[model samples]
Target: MKFTTATPTGAGPAAQFTGNVWFDVIVAGQEPSRVRVNTVRFAPGAHTFWHRHVLGQTLHVVAGVALVGTRDGVVFEAHPGETVVCPPGEEHWHGATPELFMQHLAIWETDGSDAPETTWLEEVTEEQYSAARTRSA
Candidate 1:
């Protein structure tokens, strides 16, 4: 067994997020592994740009309310301890609701080669952000 050093929290890139967001890399897999994990924190009104994973992605809410939106105008509201999964190549975006801060562990795997695990598209516009609504479970 081996202990991995911890990396300090870093700001999420402006190209990928709007408002205040931070992330700490928990696991950046090495050879023999293709998985990657990050603990992400989003301030109220903060969110990611539209993006998709090459393999897929899973998000486990750690605190506050999480609003996850998709291309088809569906938004999923996940509370603490809830897990949201995005299938491979599905365009989606997720972040904190406008009223509170939120945190989640973002989990996904690399394609295991040179291809990026995620492809980021345009940012979610004001109309999109305000249109978030809970879907029937």
Candidate 2:
């Protein structure tokens, strides 16, 4: 058995996210493995731009409330211990609620090709984020 080395926290780039966001890479698998995992933290009101994964993505919330928005104007409110899945090629964005800090484990897999695992689109507008949301039951 081997222990993995820890990586320093990285600030989510402005090109891909808005507000204050940070992440720690938990696993960036080697050649034989294509999985990737990260623990992401969002300050109040911080969130990622609209993006889609080639092989879909899963998010497991760890703290505060998380708001995940989709192209259909549906924002899903997820709390701690809740998990959300975004199917492959579905455009979506996720972040903390305006009043709270949030953190989640972002998990996805690469397609094993040279292509990027995720394609980022436009930033989520305030109107889109402020839309009414449905809480996860």
Candidate 3:
């Protein structure tokens, strides 16, 4: 049994994220494994742009509050210890609430091919963000 000591943190691309976000690769599975895991941290109000996974995605909130929104204007809320899932090819975005920093374990799979696993779309506009918060409130 081989154990990894630690995995380095990766900076989320600015083109795909707003504010500040960081990710640590917890697991990078290969061939037989087929699973990928990332421990992602977002500063208050920081969030990822609209995107969708080829094989779906799951998020387990580790601390603070998480806000996940879909293309249809539904912003699902999750507090610490809560988990959320986005079905395959369902465009969505996730991040920390405006008031608190947040961390979550993002679990997904590698399509195991050359094609990209995620397709990122436009950034969340201020109006859209505000509306979501208001609706959630």
User: All models: lDDT?
Assistant: 0.93, 0.96, 0.87
Give the candidate number with the greatest lDDT: 2
TM-score of 2: 0.98
Q: For residues 1-137, could you state the per-residue lDDT of candidate 1 as single tens digits? A: 88999999999999999999999999998778888999999999999999999999999999999999989888889999899989999999999999999999999999778888899999999889889498434
Number of the top TM-score candidate: 2
Q: Which portions of model 1 miss their true places by more than 4 Å?
A: none
Give the 10-residue window scoring lowest on summed lDDT in candidate 1: 128-137
Between candidates 1 and 2, the one scoring higher on lDDT is 2
lDDT of 2 at 56: 97
RMSD (Å) of each candidate, 1 decimal:
1.0, 0.8, 2.1
Question: What TM-score goes with each of the models?
Answer: 0.97, 0.98, 0.92
lDDT of 3 by residue, 13-94 (tens): 9999999999998888856897999999999999999999999999999998888888777787888888888899999999
